[model samples]
Target: MSVAGVGGFGLGRPRARRTAERASRKVARNVGVPLLSIVLLLAVWQGIVVFFHVAPYIAPRPRAAILAVTQNWSTLWPLVLGTIRETVYGFVIGAALGLSLGVIMAKVPVLQRLVYPVLVLSQAVPIIALAAPLVLILGFSVTPKVVIVAWIVFFPVTVNVLDGLSHVDQDLLNLARVYGAPRWRTFLQIEIPATATPLFSGLKIGATYAVTGAIIGELAASDGSSLALYQEHANSNLNTAAVYGTTMLMTAIGISWFLLVVGAEVYATPWQRRTVARRTWRRAGGESDG
Candidate 1:
């Protein structure tokens, strides 16, 4: 083999090795650190309960919470499913309405001036304060719960989508016009793609809020088969382990919804991920150089 070929192979080997090292480091930073932190937190929690002889009612140990979840899975699973269904329905409805309104407002200054202030004002009245009224009006059913979730989700989605749409590059629009592109074509090609990241950001926020809203609605409606109802029962009975377990379940649901939104964003906005990766790599390279 030629000396140049051997030199080329040597350089390629180092590059591949460097890429592997970077991937391993990223995995450690993202996964390993969080796992270690959770382990440490559990250890501290267990130690505190054991050493202080704390009553389980005050704060159950991590093991007790885990046991509660395992023991109550038969009862908890149905409630979890119910909450998930409500959340999904509300999120979908809210997102659709928010996206439509945002686009309309962005396209029409008159509508934006008329509607934006009303939205802001509506938010000033706390959601919880309206929960009882909603239950009264919608009856003690899933409708109120779904409405509450939709209401919680609507504001963030609308605001983010509007901001994204309104901030789209005027230069790009002008260029499209110069090229004789129709408004609809330009919007499809440029505006929607640009708005995706912000839209998903709003959705992620709404996703977590959706779970909270469903719980609040359930509490207000006194729904017997919901997770919130289960938590309330556990609290009243001084079953702290069950309460903690239910809380964990709610948190898991919210996080799962958030992750779904994140996954959608990553899929929809590949360029955004590439841009972030480039920035991360550059920053890491600079740190190494320093």
Candidate 2:
């Protein structure tokens, strides 16, 4: 077969392949740019501390931070574990509750009217302001941490999910009803699938908020109980490097968790991938035509 034989099926096969190669290059560029930026920033930070001869007590450098984290591994290990446990607990509980409430709010107009305003108002109230009360009511245990994480996470997921549900296509709903599909069936088949994009957005937002919630709750209840306690202690002792290290650790953990959820979203919503791919192909074909 000659090269022209392949053209019978599709003239733009070469064009499509070129487009895909360009897209892959774009993806690499996107990832590499940020990774390079971070690496550069760290290098600059390390250089500054070394050049300035910064005292470890006053302001420990990156090396000092790494050393502090490693040297105090015995003490930091337990605190890190506690924080992780609390964060995961809060994230899970909050996400579950928020998802349930969001589905209900979408289905029930009365509940939507009744609950949404209150939820919005709650967001206006600072989580820190109630941190003390949360501790007082829930005690200086894991309960408060989990509660705070859930509280922070619940709002974003609820709002996103509710919005997703509301924005579902009316035609789909009508079709479901015409077919005599049960409410649950319609919800699972039409509503949930429709809401996948927004739900994933909520999950990503909630996952990150989980860290903030855990830290706040831990700080409030800090009495040798959690990671925030140690972070606070390190800060108070002017162990700036340790503080920085722990904060970096938290950031890494949060980013990892969020990425995992995003990966799950991509995996579960293969339809979304197909839709995007189709659009991309169309766009590329049009561009090539032009």
Candidate 3:
């Protein structure tokens, strides 16, 4: 059969132009807005410092903070690596636990009732309180820090996943069962797609928390090379530029990790993309954008 839908049968140039337009818009929305916002924020920050004659020791100008990062990069680079390592390790451990426990709890509602309260209670306890005790128990090493990060990551992932599993489309599930579809087949086709969005939502939330968890862990107990330790020293010496620089680095880490999760979600869940030109994006020759 002759092609009809895509590019209006033969108008490939129009279709290509539309695709390029969409890609340009996507780039502007994703990159341009944030870049503009940051520039505006830095401008306001610089203005406030200069207009008020604020002391550098109290609140350094944004330029000073950026300079601090460049000047002290030799000292900061190790701390960055340390924090990233802790985040990755904790994310792996916590994500595994969350996924496994979510499945178990969904399958066994009675156990969920019994154990879910304890999990909630654990979170209600302040991280500082939990961190101190954990340090005492796990010792003043990277182990305690990793455990703390994992603790922060576990709750959100488990909760989102459990909710996703419990809320899967029952009608579809029944149809699968009625037709005698194998359990594995039903899971791969139906359940996995059902849960993919929420699961990644949980993962993204966990990723944002990962760096904060590491910072908390480091504050609780860590060697001198960690970000928390570096920040503490800077604050004690009233080096506010360095303080802001470290804070900016921490924020960057959290944002970068969250973006990594988002990229993974985009790759793993095509159905969620749900775009008009998904066919065009896939470069299917003569295929309908519909």
Candidate 4:
């Protein structure tokens, strides 16, 4: 009934329309930016190849790579699935065992001393060098692939977690002692939380290693069902395009696995999420104030 009420009603429609337009613009930017960037990259690549007269054998054009993927879809599907299955199984098993070992090594000084050096030395050994023996010992079955992947994934996670445990704030430890907290309680409450970032860092690295290890295992074990065998055939036939396509597929798989682990890290660390939210809110508040 008031003048203000009348004015609010009159302005509300325009405000709503403006809000919708802003939101649509934001969505368009989000979608369009990535698409435009990819288009530009492909265009540049194509132009370079055209100017240089790059042979397909040396580097397939983006169109050829795409065509190879589409054409080989049926042939590559099973091999892709097999590689994924092995990588996943290995990641889970390796993470489980490695996390347990890390916990033990960190909590007990004697065990830490005994195991840490061995873990370090094992990492120093060339992974590829061990591939043949692994195949010989475990055969071309899934066992060797899983073992190799686990071995590759284990060391990084173990080292990161152990370092995290070691660096848990002594002040926090003393505070826990003052509160009459048990050793395990202190570890769960203070140590593990403090070490979570490093642990996740290791996990992310290990996830990529898991994929690489699985590929290596496939190469060495030479089972007919694996992506390595697909590569072997492609290499033999000199279908360099297909080989490049398969490599791209492997790269995509690794990237996807890394992103999955990153998602897990972001989900597990609420402090990180809240920190980001606060920074965004502060930035918005500053802009509003300005």
Clashing pairs in 1: none
TM-score of each candidate? Answer: 0.84, 0.81, 0.87, 0.81
Error of 1 at 99 (Å): 1.0
Write down the lDDT of every candidate, Cα atoms only: 0.87, 0.83, 0.87, 0.83
- Model 4: per-residue Cα lDDT over 1-290, one tens digit each: 35656655554432222366876898689668867987898899889988999988877888898789789899889888888888988898888777888889988999999988898888888888988898888888888888888898888888888888888889889999999999888888888889889888888989988888989999889757789878878888888888888887897788789879988987778677442344533454465552
Candidate 3 per-residue lDDT over residues 1-290, each given as its tens digit = 46556656654442233477887999899989999998999999999999999988989999889899999999899899999989989988998888888878988999999989988997898988888888878887788878878888888888998999889989999999999999889977888679888899889989999999999999988856789999999999999999999999999999999989999998777666454445535765665666
For model 4, what is the C-alpha lDDT against the true structure?
A: 0.83
The count of residue-pair clashes in candidate 2 stands at 0
Evaluate residue 242 in candidate 2 and report its C-alpha lDDT on the 0 to 100 scale: 87
Model 1, runs deviating above 4 Å: 1-21, 275-290
Per-residue alpha-carbon lDDT of candidate 1 for residues 57-81, written as tens digits (9 for 90 to 100)? 9999998898999998999899999
Ranking by TM-score: 3, 1, 2, 4
- Model 2 ranges with Cα > 4 A deviation: 1-31, 47-58, 274-290
Give the range of the ten consecutive residues with the poorest summed lDDT in model 1: 9-18
Question: Highest TM-score, which number?
Answer: 3
TM-score of 4: 0.81
